[model samples]
Target: MSALGTPRPSPLPAPPPGAPTVSAPEPQEPRSRKWIVWLVLILVGGLVVWQAAVKPRMEAQAERASAVSAIKAAKVFAGTLARTVRVSGPTSSQEYTSITAPIMRGPEAGRELTLLYLVDSGKIVKKGELIAQIDAKTLEDHIDDIGDDIERAEADVRKRRAEQAIETENLTQTIRVAQAELDKAILEEKASETRTVIDRELLKLAVEEAQARLNQTKADVAHKLQAHKSELRILEITKERHVRHRDRHKTDLVKFKMYSPMDGLAVVQMTWRGGEYGVIRQGDNVTPGMLFLKVVNPAKMQVEGQVNQSESSLFRIGQKARIRLDAFPELNLAGKVHSIGALAAGGWRQSYYIRNVPVRITFTEVHNKVIPDLSAAADVTITEEENVKQLALAAVRREEGKDVVYVRKGDQFERREVKLGLSNNTHAAVLSGLEVGEEVALEKPAIQMAALR
Candidate 1:
């Protein structure tokens, strides 16, 4: 329809002289342009081949060669697939002990036995019972010696008295002779009769004899009295020394006896570590305060364990625990927690590394046969969550702040962070980030084989 008139084209003015004019380029030959476009495409194709094909294949080959090994890796993933945390720890006795009546014994130290009769092993002794008798024979011998000394002292006194008596008689005879001579002179002299002076020499000799005799007798008595008193002092000193020796002998004899300090159960002391069943013997050179055996109160008992601090989060006071005795694991003893340590048991230099405090778990209830100090393996159940969706434990890996897994969709693999609940060696409970019937990589020691096969 050419109903209305068509608009006509309008012509513009021409360019001025000496001014340059703008014009479009003329079309190139089709054959030449086609070759140019093909060459440019080839160059671009080569660059893409270098990046997408050759580079990736080279990297894959290098990775296959350079990759080291599978775990045995310390870092293991924690899958929320476990039902519980199971640990094995040794059982310990609450009342188990190496007891001895005398704890005070050592090398180059010993108790002396003069005659330790009746203090042998296996002797049941009562409190204040006489266990042995030390030789008090020395004291008896000293007493005998003192008796002899007394006899000798008495004989000396008798002999000295006899000598004094003999001297007294001799002095009396001399006095009588002097008196008779004086009497005779008196009868004859009488005033004019004093002319008896012609016999003065005889009278003088008689008087001198009497005086000498008396002086000799007196000196003999004084010497004998001094000797008797001195000997008595020696006897007194001997008596004191002997009494001390006797008392000491008695004390030593008392020490020779071993008795039960406490009355419950008696067990002999261990000669060495790991020795058992109470096999102490007589003539073992035991000393005073040496504990050869012990009696225990079995009613009270306890268990002890030392756990690594790294696993401390798995522990809490009052948590339920189970114990399996190495000697009796089939028993499956049940227990509850009573306490835990607030401080580490050992020092940095301590054998157990006191640097990390030991968490002590006690069996709140125990079987009677599960005696205190009875060594057993303990499992502390720190936490438990039930009725949760659980999966194979191998699928979980502990990541920076949470549990994670590699989730597979169709043929592509992607990372999925998961939230965990409870776990055991067999399975872990899935709390979130995963669904039922979804296939998750086991991520186990054998996981590498899935890719290889």
Candidate 2:
């Protein structure tokens, strides 16, 4: 019977009259098994082909796409790379003159002097301009008193001299009168020779008496003259003393009027006063030898900065630099390292742990905007080597405790170790293991998970 459950046809007219009626052979199990085996073999062969060729090709394509997307490349170059040190500080004049309180030594040492008048800070002063005035009223009054004393001493000296001269003349006249009396007595004694013995004896006694009086008068005149001369010497000494005092007072008076030693901008100095710190101004009391003001030459300016101890070794005198003022950023000035501190000092605002070395950079060209105490930054080119292989800092990577970079070779990247030298923020000097014009990976390339699986 047909598998469709349909009725079979009648036995083909009984298989013709004499035809032998042969029974159909029963279905063979071996034949059916053979056909099933053939179908399984075809499917296995197809799967083997896909695994061997198609699948591998697809994976390779995916990996190529990922590498193209993830990896960034840069070429190494041979050029000059500058190693620079950046520091910031205030601008100041290379040359400045200080104005200090006049020091009166000896008995007046340590005296606090008051400022009666002060020129406004930041004012431009020409050479010889009056910049300040100390409290000179007291000094002036003292000078006037000294002048009076000097005048009085001069009068006294003249009076003493006149008295001495008059005394000397009177003594001279008295001595002359005594001499005349002695001579007249001598003559009278000679003339009495013809007289008797008693008369001659009287004459000789008179002559002796006259001679003694004359000698006494001469002695008195010498003593009086010596005493008068001594008095005159004392008066003269007194007058000279007054004159010296007067001269000293005059010099002190001149000190009270302060003048600018050179043309510059005046900057008032900070002072400790009234138990606090503040700038010096009019009516402020200052001590002797205390700095009162500064006159800075604006034409010659410098940037006074400090370099960190770590970077201090790179700095040296005569290195070129670029200065930028924070207040006037538009102004760019060229400069050079003028000086470096001999020893490291405390960092700004006393940052104890991080020490710094002071550096002074003098400007090459003068600018009007440059002034003292303006905040400025300096970029000092410490080392500049030409024709050296260099690479971008991003291209360098650290791996396994060593400096490394991914060097591109054809379509694949290989990891290589590199020796490095001086470096700045943007670029690094390549000491070895890298060549100019070679391409390197800036970042690691991505790997495909499907390909790995």
Please, what are the lDDT tens digits per residue for candidate 2 over residues 343-434?
Answer: 98884578577788889999998987887878999899988899889999998889899999988887678889999997888999999999
Quantify all predictions' global Cα lDDT against the true fold: 0.54, 0.84
Maximum-lDDT candidate: 2
The clash count of every prediction, one per candidate, is 42, 0
Give the worst 10-residue stretch by lDDT in candidate 1: 67-76
lDDT of 1 by residue, 1-453 (tens): 222333443555677988788664553444665687789899999999989999998887665443313222222333322223344444444443343333222221254324333343433344444443434355346445655665666666566567756765775676566566556555444443343565555555555665565566556656755665566556655555545544544444344455445434444444542455444454344444555554444444445666656766667677776767776657776676656667665655668643453555555554656543456666666556645666666777787977887665544344788776666666776778877666666654335635554
For each candidate, what TM-score against the reference?
0.45, 0.66
CA displacement after TM-score superposition, residue 209 of candidate 1 (Å): 22
Model 1: per-residue Cα lDDT at residue 251:
48
- Off-target runs (Cα >4 Å) in candidate 2 are 1-79, 85-91, 104-111, 195-209, 304-316, 324-332, 340-359, 373-377, 386-389, 392-402, 406-414, 419-421, 431-453
Q: Candidate 1: lDDT over CA atoms? A: 0.54
Best by TM-score: 2
Where does candidate 2 clash, by residue pair? none
